[model samples]
Each structure stands twice: as C-alpha cells, then as structure tokens.
Target: MESVAVVATDRAERYGKQLVGHMSRKISGEWTGQSGYLDFNGRGRVELSAGADALKLELTSDDSETERLEEIVGVHLARFGSKDGMSVAWNRKSSEAGTVQGPYSEEDMKAFAEARKARQKA
Candidate 1:
C-alpha cells in the first residue's frame, strides 16, 4: 500500500504522539504511542506512524474509498493540529488513487468543530 508522509516541522514528536492517542480513542482503534492503526469499521484501515518530525499515514482498501478516507483523516488531523497550521497533501502515485487536493479551509474546519461538539453532546 502507498502512504502519505508529512512533517509537522514546527511541532514536536509529543504532539504527534498525542494526536495518535486521541485518534485511537476517537476512532476506537488500538494505539501504541506514536504508532498505531485505525480500522474505520468498514470504510478501511489506516496505518499511522510518527517520528520526531513526521507522521506517516497509509490507507488500505479500494481506491475509490481511499479518497474519502483521506479526507476524513486529513480533516481530523488538521483540526487537531490546527494550532501548528497543519496541512495534509496526499502524494498520489497511481491512477487508482484520485488526484491530490488542497487542505480543508478555515470555514470548513469551523463547521467540522461545531458538528463534533454537537455529536459529543448527543
């Protein structure tokens, strides 16, 4: 499977590690510090790994579904890592995978956060 690697140049490894922890809980996946995997139930599985300066992410499943999965993961990551100006740019290498796109906008992110809050209150 192919993966997208990104560096949070201004963020520390602890930040990446903590993000994975939150992801594990939010997605109900098994986690181990800076590395783990998320089984999006039936959508797909995402493998996550983090280094001192980078986060490596990979999704395994049909190509058609990965685009949505990428958006989901990217948006959440961007939301959590917003303080550091997080941006995820998928390095698409095959035709199966759709073309890469820009990150979520501030307006979109605000809506996402509000939705999350509403869901949590439910």
Candidate 2:
C-alpha cells in the first residue's frame, strides 16, 4: 500500500535536508539535495521531494505498517516545520486494505477501545 502527504512551506529544501540528515542517523536513508529516500529498517520506505513551495512525501509499506509509517514521518515533519505551522495530513488512495492493522501502541489501542465503547453506549 502507498499513501502520500504534502506540506506547503517556503523552506521545503531546508526541512527536506534536515529530515534526511536526522532520520539517516538512526535509519538507512539518503539525500540528494532535491530528493531523498528512507528505509524504515524494512518496515516501510519514504520518498521525499523538495520543491520551491512544497515538500512531498510518498510512503510505501505493507498494509500492516502504513499507519506506523505515517505516524513516524508525520510527527517528524510536523516537528521540523512547526515554525511555519506545517503538519502532515495523509491522503490515502482507496484500496482493499483493512483499516485496522496491528502492532499498535498499547496506549493508542486502549484509547481507541474506550472511544468505541463510549460511542456504542451513547
């Protein structure tokens, strides 16, 4: 499965470089000024393109790993571009993949369950 997100900012290249540099230290990733790619230790991969006015991210992973990938990359991008009020809202392409994939954080799972119960009881 693949999902994409784009953030509009004047400093796209700056954030692109910073993201690649920081993420590369912990993962296998490479940057080439205008474009970068990251491998999430076999779980997923991210391709980043830096343009004059926008930073585009193409994330590819199995259905099981898509949400985790989104969260990881989204959080990092949000942090990097917070100064410009930048955040990532992923636009997923419709597919046959199930929405609830596992390996989720315990806290999030608990919260989700609680919300579900609350809605059911209402």
Question: Best TM-score goes to which candidate?
Answer: 2
Compared with the true structure, model 2 gives a TM-score of 0.75
| lDDT for position 20 in model 2 | 87
Q: RMSD in angstroms, candidate 2?
A: 9.3
Backbone collision count in every prediction? 0, 0
Model 1 / residue 67 / CA error / Å: 0.8
Tens-place lDDT digits, model 1, residues 1-122:
34464645455445455656677676766657667777877767877777767777777756667778777777667666666666777665564443343345778678878998999999
The TM-score values for the models, in the order shown, are 0.69, 0.75
Writing each residue's lDDT as its tens digit, candidate 2 over 8-121 gives 888888888899899999999998979999999889999999998999998889888988888878767776665566767777775543222223345645676798799999
TM-score of 1: 0.69
Q: Which portions of model 2 show Cα errors greater than 4 Å?
A: 95-122
